[model samples]
Target: MILVIGGTGTTGRIVAAKLAERGHPTRIASRHPSTEGVRFDWYDPTTHPDALRDVRAIYAIPPVGEVDPAPIMLPFLERARSAGVRRVVLLSSSAIGPAGHGLGMVHARLGELFVQWAVLRPSWFMENFVGEQPHAVSAREQGEIVSATGTARVGFVDPADIAEVAVRALTDPTPHNTDHLITGPEALSYDEIAAVLSEVSGRPVKHRAIDPVGLAARHTANGIPPDFARFLASLDTAIAAGAEDRTTSTVADVTGRTPRTFRDFCRDRLRGDRPG
Candidate 1:
């Protein structure tokens, strides 16, 4: 059985669904399951064993909003190894590296912990513009998207593409003991993205750039922890410094199809469902 951690999340749900579609006996693990799944919590170690039962491969998503997930994840991973889990596909981010903070620490040690391992360092998600995140909320309510990334470009990929790659990593016969840098076809600036959003939805959307400190403060006001907010702000600051100004073909190479653009993603979402 393939175990999908964070199975109800943005990418995890798609990964679980794709695994099932491919005839894999998939097990969904969540902190609060809405369906027939195991209750798995990162802070609760006792739940680990039951979730790992009969599971051979795992699609691992580190605890959300965590600054450092390696310490919490390592013990569970060790137990997974002891429980006979062989393959592990960890979802990481392009901004963080093997030696960087957060899930990067998990990426640093993923290879030696399992027989088959892959670290997916996907770029920013386009879903952020339509989901419950601050970007989406602001766009829907205020007709603007705020960020610290001033005039910077990003290759925002769809979560479905990321999920497809995750499925391949989990089920592929060979151990792809390497990191995959996933991204969409083109890099686009926030201003460009806002213009596209305006065109697609026929709304007057705009990009509002602010300082990193201000962005962090806004995130904190939205109930995000101070440190996590600062971390997110730092990512935006990095983007402003041209950190995410490139694109990659990983999605097409892995999935045999071109990754969707921001316009396509927006068009699909706005076709029937109006933004709240």
Candidate 2:
């Protein structure tokens, strides 16, 4: 059976559903036990065994917002390995590299721990702008999207595309055994995204750029933990420096299908005169 960590989350649920659709024996790991998921929590090691029971492979979404997730993740991974789990698919971020900090540590460890593994480093999610997320809420209620990215462009990707590739990595006969830097079809600036939102919703939407310090302060005021809020703000500077101004064919190369575009995402999610 394939154990899907964080199975109730954005990409995890999609991954679990896809695995089931393909007739794979899928076990969903959640803090809340349900018919669809098994009880699991990263902070609680006692919950690991039940989730790892008879599992062959794993799709790991490590502890969120951890600048250093190695401590928690490495232990659990070792436990999974001891429990006979073989292949592992890690959901990493494009912002974090194998040689970089934070999840990068876990990224490096996965390769050493399991020969059959794939690391998915996907670009920023398009869903960040179409749901109840801060960006979306601000766009709807305040008529603008706030960021510290300045005028830099990012290869904003769809979660479904990421999930498709995750499914492939988990179930394929031959392990990918490498990291996939996944992205959408094109790169776009937050300014251009605002323009698209304006056209789709027929509203005067705009991107409100600010310094990382200011953004961090705002995020903290909005109830995010101060340290994590600062970390989130810091990542925007990487974008402003042109770190994400590129796209790749990893999606099509892995799934043998074209990944969806931002415009396509806007059309499908943002509708009914809403700013979604």
Candidate 3:
């Protein structure tokens, strides 16, 4: 059976659905127990045992709100290994290296523990414009997308692409045992993203670059912890330094198909209407 951690989330939900469509024995793990899955919280060890029962493979999405997730994840992964789980596919970020902080540490550890593992280091999700994040959606509504990224570009990948790659990694007999730098078809700046939103939504949209201090203060006001807020702001600062402006072919190589472009995403999710 395949255990999909964070299965109700953006990429996880799609991964679970695709596995189900393929007639794979799949179990979804979430914080809340549901008819569809079991309650599995990484911070809570009691839930881990039940979630790992009869599961052979896992799609692991680390717990949110923790900058350094190794403390919370390493123990559970050790338990999973003990439980006879062999394969693991981790959802990580493209910006973080194997020895870097946060999820990078988790990625490094995964390689040490499991031979049957693939780390998906995907670029920023295109869903950030149309999904839960306020910046891009607010741009469609209020004509301005605010960011600390300045004019830097990102190869914004689609969540569907990430899910597809995750499924391949989970089911493949031979493990990749390497990091796949997943990206969209092209790199684009926030200014260009705003222009695309304007064309797709038929609205006048603009990109507004903010200072890191102001961005941190805004996140703090929205109830995020000070340290994490600063960390998030720093990501944008890195982007402004030209950190995330590259594309890769790993998506196509892994999934046997080209990754979707930002234009394709806008056409499907943003065309002829305001972002929800």
Candidate topping TM-score: 1
After superposition, candidate 2 runs with Cα above 4 Å error: 273-276
Q: What is the lDDT of candidate 2?
A: 0.92
lDDT scores in order: 0.91, 0.92, 0.89
TM-score for each candidate, following the candidate numbering: 0.97, 0.97, 0.95
Best by lDDT: 2
- Reference-based lDDT, residue 71, model 1: 86
* Candidate 2, position 222, lDDT: 95
Taking the tens digit of each residue's C-alpha lDDT, what string does model 3 give over 105-187?
Answer: 88988877787999999999998888557776577567888889988999999999999999999987788888899999999
Candidate 2, residues 150-266, lDDT tens digits: the string is 999999999999999999999999999999999999999999999988888767889999999999999999998899999899889999999999999999999999999998898
Off by over 4 Å in 3: 272-276
Better of 1 and 3 by TM-score: 1
Q: Tens-digit lDDT track for model 1 on 184-260?
A: 98999999999988888777899999999999999999999999999999999999999999998898887799999
- Model 1, CA-based lDDT: 0.91
Give the C-alpha miss distance for residue 203 in model 3, angstroms. 1.6
**Which portions of model 1 miss their true places by more than 4 Å?**
274-276
